[model samples]
Target chain A: MTVENLNNINNNNAFKVPENYFDNFSQEIETRIFEENIKKQFGNKNPFKVPENYFKDFKSDISAKPKSNFAKIIRITKPWLSAAAGIIIIFTLWQFLLTGIENKNNQTGNNDSLKSKNNIVIANYQPEINTVDIKYLEPEINAYIDETDADQIYEDVNEDNNETKINSDDETVYQYFIDYADDNDYTELLAEL
Target chain B: MNAAASENKISEHISNKNFSEAFNLIVNQYKERLYWHIRKIVIIHEDADDVLQNTFIKVWRYLENFNQNSKIYTWLFRIATNEAITFINNKKKKEEESLGTYEHRLSDTLESDEYFDGDNAQLILQKAILKLPEKQRIVFNMKYFDEIKYGEMSKILETSTGALKASYHHAVKKIEKFVKQY
Candidate 1:
């Protein structure tokens, strides 16, 4: 087939259509218009509505306010920056928590070993103290004394006619230190301090 | 219809405040032509119906503002053309497709449309027309199908006669090539 042969081709189209389509189309449009008039008489209320003053301010909305390039860059990057800041905060806190837990575990393990070695037999009990080691252990010993159960120790001392006054409920005056602190939250708190 | 006589009648009826009478006259005079024009642009009977109705509604609203210097049919054709183009643009935008894709979709619609009356050769011609760029398609349609003059097309499309002639010539060559291959 060539462009020259185009004039020889049939002009009639092969598309099919329903019967009386054009005749019915005019009637359909008329019906649509009648329905529209009826709807208008009922009040031309738009079934769909937009925000108040939307159409009124639509033109102004079209012309977006000019933004500085710096502001545009900030707008683009703001969400990512906030997300990174949140991640950094979480990571820093996680590292701090892990360090605290590790220090507490080491301290508790050392105290448990020392206590096992220092236990008295009571059958033929004798205590030995090394003066040089005492200097090395001074801070631990003072911390232990400050954390002692004053009520139980004082009760024992008073019943046995010793001279010490202590109140268990006064947290500032009496601190109870449990060896190993049950290896739970108390040890973490002591390590944090 | 005598363009001058109809314009005078329309103007007289409007000036006399006989709006419905004037509108009826306008519809009777232009409806079929406008329907066919819109039909070619939209390629579906239902869409043409909607656009025709909208064109009239717009004419009704803005008829008083009609510039008396131009022919009434030209003015009506211009409105019909804009309404049809707007309808297509809005439809395409809603579907999120480009104009080329939208035209292909219209060709598909032509095949399935219950009211389409064209045969295979006519369908092939329409498909070829759809493949042309939108401006050339319009130029080709007006020139080849409707036998509309370039001068009148210039007014309706707001394009120069020389450009429209060139567009129509290119469109003819492309369509001929397509038809030959088909």
Candidate 2:
């Protein structure tokens, strides 16, 4: 028969099914697909295996309290702790600065006190002039002056006149007399005049 | 209960400051899934255990910051994935090996691992899977093994759905070619 004549044959009469085959047909197809998938994936087996009781023990292993709780607590409090520490540091620095300033002020006070003490010491200080010894030596000096040669005395007097004139021109005669004469020297000089 | 209601309960517990109870619930809920995910990535039981513990520790430490914007499981998975990848990179660095050399070494380690119980075909398939780049390997594992939806994978991986889909497709193609050639 030609290809067009072959189409006239009905193939529906050639096939029969069990009574419930159509009922489970979709489920059977799904089961087959699942089986095929399993076989393709791992030949219906898991290639990777675990030790027996591994999963059982793993739950406890993982569920045990983590040691990082302490770290978390620290992390939570870290900012507050840092702020407190910063405040402490600033306080310490401020106190240090205050102490340094106080120390500087105390040293300045000490130096000023030392200067005042030194001025008092200098003001209270006196030289030993020995006015009694000078008073006793004056009469001997006048006697020795009287025993000198008259010409020598005259030359000395002339030199003294020139010095006195220069001193009187520049300074007051009372200042010169107070500087060069004692009390006994004035009486002897007046007697000679 | 559904994930939303369960998540709500956990969130309530956290809000109440019942951290210990909330953490226990989270650990019980996600430990197996996260362990398996990390196992596939790191391929060593010990390494997976370490990464799983680290992932949970991170969850515990950061649980207060969880705004419940994303599902808790997704957040856990993200932490687990990052921890696994970082663990691998750190191991690679510690070994002072180049990427190719490190991959080779990892393959050898898989062969010698006492915990791996796969048959020869499974081993061959695993080896084929391992041939993929790291991101592709993760994508393939999440899609094929975990059977996670693209939307969930996107959230966990912080990737776009379109990009994840393309990555999965390319990964499948590569794995298929590798398996066929093997």
Query: After TM-score superposition, what is the CA distance of residue A76 in candidate 2 from its true location, in Å?
Result: 31
DockQ of each: 0.01, 0.11
Indicate the docking level reached by candidate 2. incorrect
> Where is model 1 more than 4 Å wrong at Cα?
A1-193, B1-4
Kindly list the per-residue Cα lDDT of model 2 for residues B1-182, writing each as its tens digit. 66677788888877765555667678877788898899989888988876777677567556657876778888889999998888887777666878767667667787878899988888877887788889988987887778898899999999987677667666666656666654
Top candidate when judged by DockQ against the true structure: 2
Residue B139 local lDDT, model 1:
78
TM-scores of all candidate predictions against the true structure: 0.47, 0.54
Clashes of 2: 0
lDDT for each residue of candidate 1 in B89-131, tens digit (9 for 90 to 100) = 7777667896599998878877876666566666776787789
Pairs of residues at least 3 apart in sequence or in different chains that clash in candidate 1? A13-B118, A13-B119, A14-B118, A14-B119, A14-B120, A15-B118, A15-B119
